[model samples]
Target: MLIGVLLVISWLILLIRYPTKALPISMAALAGLALVASWVLWEENRDARYLAHLELRLSYDPQQCPGDRPLAVRLKNGSDAALLELRWEVAAYRPGNATNLAQRLYESPRYSGPGELLPGASWNDCLPLPDLRSGYRPSTLEFRAERLQGQFIR
Candidate 1:
């Protein structure tokens, strides 16, 4: 980024001092290339989070969720960096870590904030559950995709 800015500034200075058309064009091209390279590098590295920073909670309340909506989740941002995007899933798992999923929301619901999912900010919403029984037993095996509300690590 600094290099790109410097290139642009140099181009501006050259345009002021030297009135040659080819010189200005060459400097402008170099500046544009620098800008593009910096943007590409940022895109490739910015989303690679160094550590896990997503917090999720599942809830099922008859009063809070009427009708077919029996599952919901609250997502909290607990990272130092703003969450630019999220690839989230909701699943059910047994004690052995076998699992099933109910609903999945990907990068479509883009955060309106500009890379600013500040710490402690949370989002809560109801989820659609399908083919899950309320009377599930602990002793028996069951599929869990429907009642699950979140996946790990974005």
Candidate 2:
């Protein structure tokens, strides 16, 4: 919608500038389309840069525990801009299955008091897994990271 408005304005400007030209109308429309396309492409490039500034990784050491152990999360920030208002969740599943046996949501202390993540910084948090019934070992675990506005930048 915004691009449309911009294109219309550009077209009007071109038409006003070259009203007597043989193909003034067509030229104005094409110029307007070009302007809108350029704007869209620039915005997409900017968003890509912003996204590239951050990274998310999930890691665990199975050897750290004998059998059922608590889950540990490692959030690393690789961007120059501090990530404001970050939230994370951890879920345990039967390794390869999609069903989650246990899940926990935690707000990182680093960002608890309206904090932000600085560049090249990292945080480690742990959540203890409860004792499960026999034959309930989680084969897979998943972690998700996102910003305050539901933007999954990581």
Candidate 3:
């Protein structure tokens, strides 16, 4: 930040002293600034960009485990990377209810499965549901990926 302020000050001084000479220098600095801004933006949104290539589907079987109905999830990797770890937070909601039945709701626990998903591959597993009130049941489950880690495959 200090360096940027100093550069701006020097550039302004040059512009006041030699207007014609400062024109080319100002143009070069503007181009460099644009390049740096673009790189920084890409770095900040890298995770979201890669996550766009992933898809998730949810299915639930109420008869699978008595009071606790584990969710059957299907994750498809559409990117050119191998996924190392993946986890999601689930929200359980009953029909006509405007709120979640999960015990923690916003602070609910995350569920994960064995992850080694390669490009163009799919993984299927049953993830245990978050803690809910005993004997409480939800008609639907919502999943949102909270942890996604992957590497580009060469």
Candidate 2: the clashing residue pairs are 95-139, 95-140
Assess every candidate by TM-score. Answer: 0.42, 0.39, 0.55
lDDT-best of 1 and 3: 3
Best by TM-score: 3
Best by lDDT: 3
Number of clashes recorded per candidate: 3, 2, 0
Compared with the true structure, what per-residue lDDT tens digits does model 2 show for residues 1-154?
A: 9999998788678767876772666877679999999999986675456546656544444655434434555666666556555544434455567665543334322222125666677766554453333566444444334332312233
Poorly placed runs, candidate 2 (over 4 Å):
1-54, 58-69, 103-114, 130-135, 138-154
Clash pairs (backbone) in predicted model 1 = 100-145, 101-145, 102-145
lDDT of each: 0.52, 0.53, 0.68
Which candidate, 1 or 3, has the higher TM-score?
A: 3
Ranking by lDDT: 3, 2, 1
lDDT of 3 by residue, 1-154 (tens): 9999998899799999998998988899899999999998876476566667988776665565444546777788887767666665666666666566667666655676455778789987666677766777545445344445444332
